[model samples]
Target: MLQVFVFNIPVESGERIGFSTTLLLAITVYMTIVSNRLPDFSYLDISYLSNFLLSDVTSGILLIICVIQSLRFYHAPVMQQFPKVWVPDLIVGNPYGSNINLAENGRVVQFTNEGEAVWQPANVFEMNCVAQIAYYPFDMQNCTFGFLPWGFGVKDLFFNVVSQELMNIYFSPNGKWEITNTRLYSQIFYGDQLLRLEFTFKRRSRYEIINTVGPIIILGMLQVFVFIIPVESGERIGFSTTLLLAITVYMTIVSDRLPDVSYPDISYLSYFLLSDVTSGVLLIVCVIQSLRFYHAPDSQQFPKWVIYITKVCSKWKQKVSPKDKQHINDEQIVNSDDIHVPTASEEEEREAPPINWPMISGCFDKICICCFTCICMIRTIVLFVMLTM
Candidate 1:
């Protein structure tokens, strides 16, 4: 009965499995009825059945045939005849235009006999992010990458992450940015399910500090030293102008590293720009201060305040003579010794000169150095507080 049952039935696939099983049961019953008519059925040679059913070679060949038949049956035209809903997997590609990330292969869709399909693609992507440089080297940024089916709504297709911790393994360390946090979420956009992955990154400031910002700060501080150049030496204007130009060049270099955004975020570059403008104004003041003491006729006396400040600055360097003190008191001094001052030709011939500009320039330098120092300090503190918040 078992031999007849095994020989009458073949392996079944798909919807035909139930029919094949019923036919095998009928054959088993028929074989049992026929065996009852035989006398001495106990002596029947059943040993030969082992060669066809249980031998290793026969079993191996049967297993191989079953697998091949199953594969062929699964892909047969009968299976394809059933109606199927097609969906596509959307894989995100690199948006930052960075070459460090791996390329994205197309998505794969898998179907089952029960009319269900799953779409999954490798989630390797480096998306574009808009940089807010208002805080620049100290800024933080949020970037997102997502997938959605082109034509399917939530009813026809749905999305999910294979594992929530997948990003933890795939994230690559970057030299300029540090990943601070990550989130995976889904939302409906125009009735379509959109699965998104977001990463929040903070700027790694060591590189900018060393290469861009450090040099800018040094250049700004150098502007303060411009005040120390003696006005009479005729180097202050040239020095201040050169320093201003240097700052402009530095600003250009730093700006090249920043993104163009519509809104102002607090950026270190803004501080550099403000500092550079302040330096330019200071340079103008230096030029004007030098001009104040440049050349004056002996009859044109110094302003009372100018003389007072100049005296205060030069107290340690030179003594205030009785005549010089009297000139400060009167605000007008005609040196009797110069009553018959020479013509232009005679003045040119005389070697000795009067009208001290160095003292005036020195006084102006002291005032500017204090003002510029205060401005720079205040800006630094404000920027630090803003960035921290």
Candidate 2:
């Protein structure tokens, strides 16, 4: 009865355990009452006390066993080969189950059957990293591979910080993949003393393709300007100008997403440098084009500055040709002017000054500049965008 009341059981299961507990409690209580009433209850009373002592010993032994079992379930190793107590079920590429930790840091928690502490292991190396190793149990395709943003380390400044997304991954070459695909959604699990990196993988899909290819296409279109239009034309200027601005805008966005710190990983910092350098090149070309247009020659050769400075003297000394004056003076003049051969001095002034850059190779220079600029722009954008994604 005492066991039943203490344990709060209704005596089901044909009243087996519940009946025994009730009977034991009844006997214990009866003996206690009799021993208290009979001061000299001789051997019978002593025997009753001995029985109670045995019962107490048995209960203590049972309690100890229960505690040990609880500890074992909570902390004992599940698999000898894999010593880790908190290994997730899906790290080896099994489907189903979510250990996706969007936070930058994660924890591996272990609990026994009775909700007891086993042991927690924290780590940044997920199964995905092992997949890149090309070794047994680790060399599996469908792994994580991509560039990390530079600001990832900021979390380590004073406290733990988790990455908002899993941007870094290396996909397997066996099949196609989509950029939007998130094979390992929960990469980290927060813990008291450590962060755990849970490894996960998923099949490639169409979503990833659209997300990845879109940026490539955008960068590619910018490159088309170099090939389709003349470097010196208005079209080239407009296209490059727009592209340069776009690159700058994207760079700013990317930079903001990453951590702000002096030490950035190659993966994140590399993209920033590439975008900046490319934009610089494009802007420089823009300035050069502006100068070229401002100084464009009317007759393929610039006039001497001396002529402009001495305009009054030039007007008086260089009177209009007799034939030109005759035609201008009388609009009805129909007589054809007799041809007059010009002397050496007249011929010298008549012929426009020989085109200045006769040996400059302007065509080659323009084409080279355009080609170089386009290459840099395309390479920078494509590399950074693809890897970052």
Q: Write the per-residue lDDT of candidate 1 for residues 1-389, one digit (tens) a residue.
A: 22223333454533333443454455555555555554535565644433333343344445445545765765654323322433364544335554322113423455565566554445445667666666777888887776565556899878665654334665579998899888888888888888777778899998877987777667766777777765557777787788788778877777677765556454656665666677677667766755666554456678888776665555534444433443356767778987885797674446223337555665667777887877766666775676667
Q: After superposition, how far is residue 71 of candidate 2 from its true place, in Å?
A: 24
Error of 1 at 54 (Å): 12
**TM-score of structure candidate 2:** 0.31
Off by over 4 Å in 2: 1-213, 220-227, 230-233, 264-273, 276-280, 283-287, 290-295, 298-362, 373-389
lDDT of prediction 1 = 0.62
Give the TM-scores of the predictions, in the order they appear. 0.60, 0.31
The deviation in Å at residue 185 for candidate 1 is 0.7
